[model samples]
Target: MPQAEVDTPLDNAAVEARRAAARAVQTAFRNSGVHAMLEVATTRAAPAVSVTIPLGGTSGSPFLGGTGLPLPDGAGPLQQLLEHHDIHAQVTVIELGPDPALLVALTTGDDALRLAALVIERRSDAHDAALRLSGVFADLGITEDHIYVADGAVQVGDINVQDAITLYDVLTGQRNDAAELDLGDRWDPRTWRDVEKLAELMGPVVSKAAGEPLDCIPHPACRTCISSRPHRITLGSASPQQVLLLADAISSANSSSTSGVSPPTG
Candidate 1:
């Protein structure tokens, strides 16, 4: 026996139901809060929603100064400085934003050459400093086992205060003939920035080995480190000072959403 076949089309009700579901999802997504910070530790591209911020989007927020925060010396002159430094320095480009704001991240040579540091742009100073410190163990030379340069997607693995302790132990070792040394110190903006903890720790020892003072300021290489420090603080909530300032900026940027905020009256 042959069965009768039935054809069915969605009624207006079904279409409306589907539309309602989609709208609900869209509304929920729009209202979601995303931290405006990008984590470079991972090799993934930042989300389009965060990147497509308008000139007035993330800029006009009181946090970014109603049109983006000013670099210490501003962008124009800084560009000239960075370009000049790049000529003889180990500086390179890292990330560039839609508005063409350059995100220059740098590392020294010793710090740069490692596969872990390969994830982003590194300044030669770091590598040099790391090597200069490593020079104390120059007898070891660059071994395939100790120092490795990695390519493709590589994870930094677990990094913590304990890691610094391990390096610290190596630095304090009496042998000093060891193949690798870990020199990391405090996580403070007062001296080095994000990637510099180990460098900072190892820096002083290397400086002393090189007969230079830890405070002995080298000729300035890149202002990129200093420029990013504030941004780091702003994002990490590491420093209360930056948090207050950024919170104020966020408040101002989103003043419309903050009904309880009292506007300054002239």
Candidate 2:
């Protein structure tokens, strides 16, 4: 009978090397302004990490008047909209899988009913509201192809890193283009793994930088409707530095066999 093959356990040196690698990855994430928690691999799952980046917004209520809304020194489009149109809303950056999308929660009324009536009645008020909302998004650097309106919300998908950074600056009173990071040319990820990892890291960072949450109004009907569906946000951009760091970490972790360094396997 052939002998059963057994996996060799990592030596102490190999184990220490893996630990150092993990610490390096964690430090890199921290330097990029993201908080990450590393999860040791289990029998049923691979090693993973969860991150929390600064997303500026009201924590309790996702409304402008609510606590923790980072108002800019100058009035941006969102502020302008509230001051001029009296449209109470919330703006948040969210992650829909590997994509980053923008969510604009319109006024807390029966938006579905109002929008439906506008289609039939052809009322100028509703039409004007839609136009104004579109303009607001446009002023925020959202293009037409990325915009979608449904269920009383406006979602802008496929936003680049610059767009998110600009929004963050507007909300946090930071200098625009402070990082000088233009990720447009490097936006296309080399692999799905890279895409997924970038999504995981960038989502929280961008969202925190923007500081907003998707606070839907507490209308019974609307709440039910919202609960019935899943919420999604898409991010379409990542910095080259971020990508390179992530790639290095992933490569090191995955090449454990060749490097004789076992990854965290709990």
Q: Cα lDDT of all candidates, in order?
A: 0.28, 0.35
lDDT of 2: 0.35
Cα lDDT tens digits for candidate 1, 27-101: 322222111221121112221111111222333122122122323233354345444444211222233454423
lDDT tens per residue, model 2, 146-208: 443222233334444344444334433343333443233323332223333334444544444
Instruction: State candidate 2's TM-score.
Output: 0.26
Best by lDDT: 2
Once superposed on the true structure, which residue ranges of model 2 sit more than 4 Å away at CA? 1-130, 175-186, 190-212, 215-266
Return the TM-score for candidate 1, rounded to 2 decimals: 0.17
